[model samples]
Target: MPDNREARAAARTDMIMRTTLALAQETGYAKLSIEAVAARAGVGKHTIYRRWPSKGLLFLDSLLSLNEPALDYPDTGDVMADLRRQIYAAVDLLTGPQWGPLYQALVGEAQHDPAVAAGLGERFIRPQTDKTVARLRAAQEQGQVAPGFDLDLAMSILSGPLYFRFLISQEPLTRDYVDRVLDALFAGMGPRGPADAPASA
Candidate 1:
């Protein structure tokens, strides 16, 4: 496979995406334009349009390319440890300031753009969230979690506090904060043993 042409095209695409992310980081999405992206990317106007028909499509693709690979569920012979690792991996990505603004803009845009909303749900949310639920289910099968624990509800509990910290309180997202949330969640949902017996008379 000595196709020089394909390799060059791929490199150009990568350059465009890198340049687009840099611009989007410097300026809000509302100010993004094809011309600006072309200038930043060092590509011709026709080159940009040849691939993406609209700014929304280009922006969506650019944002998606920035995501890290989904964290695979680890089987460390201990459910609690595995879950803590998985949840924290997600939290780390969300708290990174470079990508946080992009996520915020995407969420805000999803409120009005059905196309972007659907794309987000399919491409990013489903893949990552499904892994989380699967990990929880594996733990449940091993009796490490309560049999009646609602998987969806449980994930929400694990993530809800972190989201509130970042999106509501606007506080610094720190490991200590994540640890506290995980502790409270585990207290509520982790395994339960037999209740203590009544005291002797």
Candidate 2:
């Protein structure tokens, strides 16, 4: 357990992150200010600065903290099944009430603000991409993915439709759609062979 001072500091930091996400969702990140977060979080501005150099970092930290817990992938040995499960769980959370507003606000603001864009990519997008790539490579070692497949393209195939639906199409994201995405991706990347033959390396 944390000592009194450490416990208080942790509590204060959580408050700041919670407040930043809420205010940013309501006011939008482009309009959110450190002063407002401090005011809402009930902490001095200096307390925020002590950890994050600016409001963008503070906002990014809040997003990273929120995403970290949900990002863990439980490998069930069947790579495709695991990927589908993880993607659906993520889509559910991103589309759900608790975090969707902040997600949309951050993404909307990132388009107009380069710092926010970089922070979002660095903190959120890149980690997810890298993690997926690592899993794809592992799947290849197990002969689940063709050796010729590009890991980057694999990441895109997994995420492209999900984001397109989330940010553009605004269609309902279903588990069936998630399964289809992976199935199509695998078919394209799978080995070339006769219809009844096994895939070759």
Candidate 3:
């Protein structure tokens, strides 16, 4: 009986999240409301409220559920290749008609709402950052990356420009842009040679 209850709850939550995404895609974040989602999902608004404290968090979870598979890092032993593949996949998603605008709206909302910002960081940003740092650390351990630089900072450096272009500057974000960023990052982070070392400074 307990197992059955849990299954039903999980099914309901999935339905709610899917409904949220569908509504957000159709009506957009600015116009979407918990009441609408509750009505569409055939659940009480309290059910969503119990799961997610705010609309921002609910939307965040919904987007994550849909995009997690595409955003996951691939471990192919070639760190640069793996990173490139994952980043390209992200670019595709971020540039897609459905997710791109919704994510942009969420980011805008998070700017003024601390709860949303915190939720975004805790639920989405940190996990991605941790995965990136882990991958970089693995490369460092395998001698593919130079030692002594902070992997956490390295992860930020890798992602910073992309976000800047995507969200801030509103510049073109393309695979070529990703490749250039990777080229610069790897050139600096790759194992240094004696000749490449700094002379007496």
Q: Please report the candidate that would top TM-score against the real structure.
A: 3
Query: Cα RMSD (Å) between model 3 and the true structure?
Result: 2.4
lDDT winner? 3
Task: List where candidate 3 sits over 4 angstroms from the true fold.
Answer: 1-8
Q: Write the per-residue lDDT of candidate 2 for residues 104-186, one digit (tens) a residue.
A: 77787688768889988987888878878887788888878877789898898789898898888889888888889988998
For residues 102-187, could you state the per-residue lDDT of candidate 3 as single tens digits?
Answer: 88887888898888888778877888888899989998998889998789878988999999998999998999999999999998
Question: How many residue pairs clash (N, CA or C atoms closer than 3 angstroms) in each of the candidate models, in the order given?
Answer: 0, 0, 0
- TM-scores for every candidate against the unseen true structure: 0.83, 0.80, 0.85
Q: Order of candidates by TM-score, top first?
A: 3, 1, 2
The true-versus-predicted C-alpha distance at residue 155 of model 1, in Å, is 1.3
Q: Residue 3 of candidate 1: its Cα lDDT?
A: 86
In model 2, the Cα lDDT at residue 16 comes to: 93
In candidate 1, which residue ranges exceed 4 Å CA deviation?
2-4, 196-201
Q: What is the C-alpha lDDT of each candidate?
A: 0.79, 0.82, 0.89
How do these models rank on lDDT, best leading? 3, 2, 1
lDDT of 1 at 111: 73
